[model samples]
Target: MSSKARHSLDPLNLDRFNHEALIPLVSPLTGKNYIGWCNHIELLLTATVKLDFITGKCERPTERAKAEQWDLVDSMVRSLILGSVSKEIAQHFIHAKTAKSLWEEIKGRYGSHGPLLYRIHRKLRSIRQGNADLFEYYSKLCNLWSELHYLKPIPVCKCKCNVGKEISVGECNGCILAKQIADDKSETELFQFLMGLNDCYDNVRDLILLMEPLPTPSKAYSMLLGVETMRELSKGEKGCEKTHDLVCSYCKKIGHTHEGCFKLHPKTKRSM
Candidate 1:
């Protein structure tokens, strides 16, 4: 095989996989954040095609040679599990015989479902846009939604029958799609987003709702940004103007951007 072909075949060359680089941990996993940490590790392993080693889908071969290879792969996965966690936590599971055992030990200790899931739901409900910017509030809510989805993913519909014609309409609506799919009003992200905003946004909220199909939370946010800008201008709160931050591509100087540079727009400059 050519060198390039050989390289392609060995994509999962164990030495090439850097645990920290692949996992992107802000800090080593602490017991409190086991869910988020496990999510990251799962993605990394699945991408590398080594998930089965840790998931117990790949069993050890009875043949001596194959069993030895299996042990080597299991050790690598076990090392990855250890490297991902804090040193203190790693001590407890370092002696596990298989990667799956280590993973289960961590999950069994910290992955208590009933109480943790309840807290996640409660926290999701408690979030609001009060006293925060629209973008900031949206980010917080979406992040929690993301983490929740990862922990308990909704089942994928793998129907062989294609619905033929696309059924897309005003997905921008305040969760018409949610009502149809989930058949629950509370499951609507759009509804949750709109209802969370402060009373100061009541007029804009009404305008958003009056539309035939309500604007998406994102579209509503953009509209609200316009309103926020108008409100700021009305209060004489002019936003920061980074005039010096701009650089002219033509003249290579501060004070004007490439589009506004006098050299680039000579005719307009002359007219001015």
Candidate 2:
């Protein structure tokens, strides 16, 4: 067999499969779209970990066998990574020999912790539920939160407390930091969401803030939603009321019967 043909048959040669056959097509990760695209690719790579493609774990192997397996896994990962990106980006890293090198190249060019944090903060500030659907507004905020979490993952406390006894809730350093962050974020998020609210909600928002323990972000959302619903209901009731309340031209009073109206019945006319 030809050397080229033999390489195609190798178990790790992902290129042999049609691009769509191995992994679904996703949009290229341009600098502008890097955050969401990176998130999606990261999840795909995580799932692929179980197949021994990520870390290339081999329990036992001879010197040459292990090396070949690692090379095969790297080839597969590189192919998948290149396949998912735009041709322009792919061309830039076309010569990259390993998945790790390509990954680092992309991260170096596009990912910067400082700028990402600033952008996230700006997004959080500008976001408002506004005329948009409530669920969509909440989902957009959630996506931002997820990206922020990825950029700065919360640390887990590993120290044992009370010598094997399970640590009580809220006692760990991680929990304290997480709660503080959440509390701070909640204040900003609640205000952003409130600012976008219709003017009719001004009173409701004021009332919410005045409460002893101001509502959590989720509770505030619920209260605002309820207020919106009631406003809609009140508007509908007023419309119905307008239709039912009929004032007599002559009697100048509502619910005036024909028998009581001097204009309609001259015989029942009264002095001016």
Candidate 3:
């Protein structure tokens, strides 16, 4: 063989060889000799081509040929970081045409206050392929954070233990305690509990006001009386003085003090 042919025949030169020349060069070596040294070379080349395609570096596929590989890389990174629990979520990342679009979706979905979203963006920007698993874990956390953000707090009664009066929309200590006890319940169950309490309170408030002296009942006793009795009480009010510290003067809700009210119109159409 000539020097060029000898050099081409060398296994170490595989990296420098072009795809067109690789098949022909390997045609001579066969049996154990080729199998031991260059059997995996074809497979390796195939994998490299696939990776290039996935990363948008492939020369073929004319429509997507002009697309930037970095954009695809960014989308991959974002997808892994922002955990896709379903095929739909995974498709979002896979179909994204640019890093900017993917980033915009993330911001629109998760960014309300600037700080939290910015912090997440910064963290994602710092991660690379070497730490891919960490990136994936962070993505799941982001999804969880987004889910928790929209989660409504469990509604509680709006009556003061001392006043023994119920309002149309109120949150009291008993309501808060009940919510805590129902913490393990599903969101649907929690919602039902809140709606049931609201309806029951409205019914009892009208009946109790018609009676002479307002009836007084302990928080625990009132809760145990069930929705029906609480709805029909002619003259009784429950007190939640035990959770005085948890009461919010602004929204009149328990489990959060006035300072902790998250409502935009906390007391009088003013941001809290």
**TM-score per candidate, chains pooled:** 0.68, 0.65, 0.18
Local distance difference test scores for all models: 0.67, 0.63, 0.38
RMSD of model 2, in Å? 13.1
lDDT of 2 by residue, 1-272 (tens): 99887766544545544434445656677676777777776666554442334333422245786667767667777787788888888889889866777777887887888888899889887777566665577678778877887787644445454233332236677656655676666676667666765554455666667766666767877765554454345455421122222334455433343445667887766554
lDDT of 3 at 182: 40
lDDT of 3 by residue, 1-272 (tens): 89987755433233342444443333332221222212233343443332332233433324553334434434443343233223444354555554345434543554444554455445444433232332343344344334333342344455554244322232556655654544433332222222323232333334433434333322222332443332234224342222233434676543445555677344643532
The better candidate by lDDT, 1 or 3, is 1
Weakest 10 consecutive residues of candidate 1 by summed lDDT:
160-169
- Which residue pairs in candidate 2 collide? none
Runs with alpha carbons beyond 4 Å of true place in candidate 1? 1-16, 20-26, 162-179, 182-187, 229-272
lDDT of candidate 1 over 170-242, digit per residue (tens): 3334234533553332236667778888766665566567776666666777776765665455445543222
| Deviating ranges (above 4 Å) for candidate 2 | 1-22, 50-62, 161-168, 172-174, 229-272
**Candidate 3 lDDT score at position 154:** 42
Top candidate on TM-score is 1
